[model samples]
Target chain A: MEAGKRINVVTKILAANDRVADENRRRFAELGLKVVNLISSPGAGKTALLEATIGRIRKDRRVGVIVGDIATTKDAERIAKHDVPVVQITTESFGGSCHLEASTIRQALDEIPLKELDLLFVENVGNLVCPAEFDLGEQAKVSMLSVTEGEDKPLKYPLAFQVANLVILSKVDLVPHLRVDMEALRANVRQMNPKVRTLELSSQTGEGFDAWIEWLKKP
Target chain B: MHEASIAQNVIESVLRLIADGTVQGKVARVYLKVGKLTAVVPDNLQFMFGVLAEEGPLAGVKLEIEEVPIRVRCKACEEAFEMHEEIRLICPKCGSADTRFETGRELLIDAVEVD
Candidate 1:
């Protein structure tokens, strides 16, 4: 009986992206590589941290990097000086998607020497809200939160806080000057997701970076 | 705004429904279940839906968004509750900070209503 044109269907809005994320996961699994998605708001020190992280780990670990920006090879350029295989996926054609989708990563994966690296870091475009939504099939989604962004950031952008496996509070050296309440920031992050591990560091001063390097130590 | 892509996703889902041929006639509304945790703003989604869901069978389709509150549970005491504010995460009884999300952080088209 066509009494009413009623159709009941359940759909996942990210089904397409999730499918690509799954494929990327399988690809990374086959290559036996650990991929970490480095997400942050713009100017949160993602590139700087990567440059520092790669420098510290390159002696022992074969690391590769992929940089995604709305439009720029500047990050890729910065990582190249570290003598690693880095590719830049500029999303100018994709209407400047603020996040890195699995499909974007898939296209850039071909140029990366998957078999030659122990760890791969995908520095996603700097936006807390959008990048938190797209999963690039990384082993962990790590976000960098700087002190200047304020303590209420996690509460205001809870999705970024909730989804991140780990959150690194960057630019701690500026905390004294910026009046960033570290405890309040930690409380906000814990309230959003108590399970998220956090670390406070200053890349410029090289403070609290040993633990960062230690966390990435090959297991 | 990513709503442009999100609106496209809604249309794709609706198209798939029509392709399945289970429901008859035109699509009147697309019901979306947006968790409070997702960053998709309702207004943006609505505007994008209006713009992107304009071609073919999805033209002039309505989007009904149901926002779900963020729910969490204490890992230490198994306290299942929703927080009005994100700063207060302590278990009222146990006072433990060990808590995890039990819900929220979801964005899905739960069920679409067809005309």
Candidate 2:
């Protein structure tokens, strides 16, 4: 072997993941199912929001969930109470991947009744940064930030906000008690992603959830 | 962090190249291009790569990373420029909020040096 031989192999690092994601997207489209990838930091009310969403939309829309967590089937158990088919992807067994990759979701899809569900929510493992990097073939990527997390989160974690199709300011019911500035938070999110739609809602209070439900119903 | 997973992917990619005879010799270095918008921390990626490469054909391989700056095109004024100080999507020229990223989310293995 000769020294200093250079091979120009320009290739996307996540090509395999992206290819799987594209296939997932096609599969979802063919099934006429709307898939939403929910990303957030820990304790951002993703499961609670899903529980609320399922309660409201279940009457008209058949919903299924794929919950990704570092460990535990706790979230799946919670969603199962809502009587919807839910699958849990525990990353701990698979080297504790911080985020859910497309391949993981593809495997999870095998357990889901895709033909019966109108909407599928993939509750990504609660981490803002890593989840944004991996595309999961969702029609929308919704990122949640709680009021307690601080107003500067969007600026600090710009990539998560930049890629989000919708930014949900969760736990808005606690805003009055906290020192966090809602205006500043909104402005920071806007700075990172100008075109992203934002909604301030508290899953606990159900305040501002009507808009969220409406957004979910959009064609 | 996801850098570990990314490092594994990088090693796998190179190994695949070698298996297919795309990469002929033992790899000395892997050159990666990561954009500013990517979540990867270059230092972390390098560390992870070194650790994960210790057992494979990529053992003792040098990981070279080139950071790519964020560039955006203003939809309003059609001016394309690089974002320097901060990653605000607003256009610098037109001051318009309607702008699309041109080159910032890149995560690619550009080339490999073999011996």
- Using all chains and alpha carbons, the TM-scores for the candidates as numbered come to 0.91, 0.94
| lDDT of all predictions | 0.83, 0.91
DockQ of each: 0.56, 0.76
Judged by DockQ cut-offs, the docking class of candidate 2 is medium
Error of 2 at A152 (Å): 1.2
Q: Model 2, B43-110: lDDT tens per residue?
A: 99999999988977788999999999889888899988887767777776778999888998899999
For model 1 chain A, give the 10-residue run with minimal summed lDDT. Answer: A1-10
RMSD of 2: 1.8
lDDT of 1 by residue, A1-219 (tens): 454344556678889889999999998888888899998899999999998788778888899999999997999999999999999998888888777888889999999998999999999988988888888888889988999999889888877877788889999989879877899988888776676789889888889899888877744
Could you say which candidate leads in DockQ?
Answer: 2
Residue clash pairs of candidate 1: A5-B115
Error of 1 at A114 (Å): 1.6
* Displacement of the residue A90 alpha carbon in candidate 1, Å: 1.9
Off by over 4 Å in 1: A1-3, B21-24, B75-79, B85-88
lDDT of 2: 0.91
